[model samples]
Target: MFYTYILASQRNGTLYTGSTDDLAKRVFEHKEKARAGFTAKYGVDKLVWFEAFEERENAFRRERRIKEWRRAWKLRLIEETNTDWRDLYDDLNNLLSY
Candidate 1:
């Protein structure tokens, strides 16, 4: 499986759009600031929204598209499913553990 995910510094804060085959590990890295990049520098480590895809291309495409979207559009997209902008990383890990 692949995933397109959005990470936010906080509710209505800095946001990041990315795609990865391993969603849990990638998000964990962002949270831990494991790499020196936009996510770590901007402190955008809260998993606010995500979508899974059977194909890596699809996930990558969705991530690219979302990255091009306006901030308002991105915020709306996140709010659509995560109105309160809760961190979803823990939930993702729980699901994987099961």
Candidate 2:
């Protein structure tokens, strides 16, 4: 599966939107600051939201759309799905069972 995900530094904080074939691995890398870029520099590594897709194309498209949205719109999207804005990364282990 593919996924479109959002990572935030905190509730309504620095936000990032991206698509990946492996959500768990990508979020883990961000949390670890494995690469030197926006996520690391801005400390936006808390997985806040994600949606799975059957195809990569759809995931990428959704990611692009989300990225283009205004900050308020994006915040609403996140709040609608994750009202508490929890760090979804903490739940990844249970989701993956690995």
lDDT of 2 by residue, 1-98 (tens): 89999999999899999999998989999989999999999999988888888899999999999989999999999998799999988897686553
For model 1, the superposed segments whose C-alpha errors exceed 4 Å read: 94-98
Residue 44 alpha-carbon offset, candidate 1, angstroms: 0.8
Q: How does residue 21 of candidate 1 score in lDDT?
A: 96
lDDT of each: 0.93, 0.91
lDDT of 2 at 28: 91
In model 1, the worst 10-residue window by lDDT is: 89-98
Number of clashing pairs per prediction, in order:
0, 0
Q: Specify the highest-lDDT model's number.
A: 1
Provide the lDDT at 71 for model 2.
99
Q: What would you estimate as the lDDT of candidate 2?
A: 0.91
Candidate 2 off by > 4 Å: 95-98
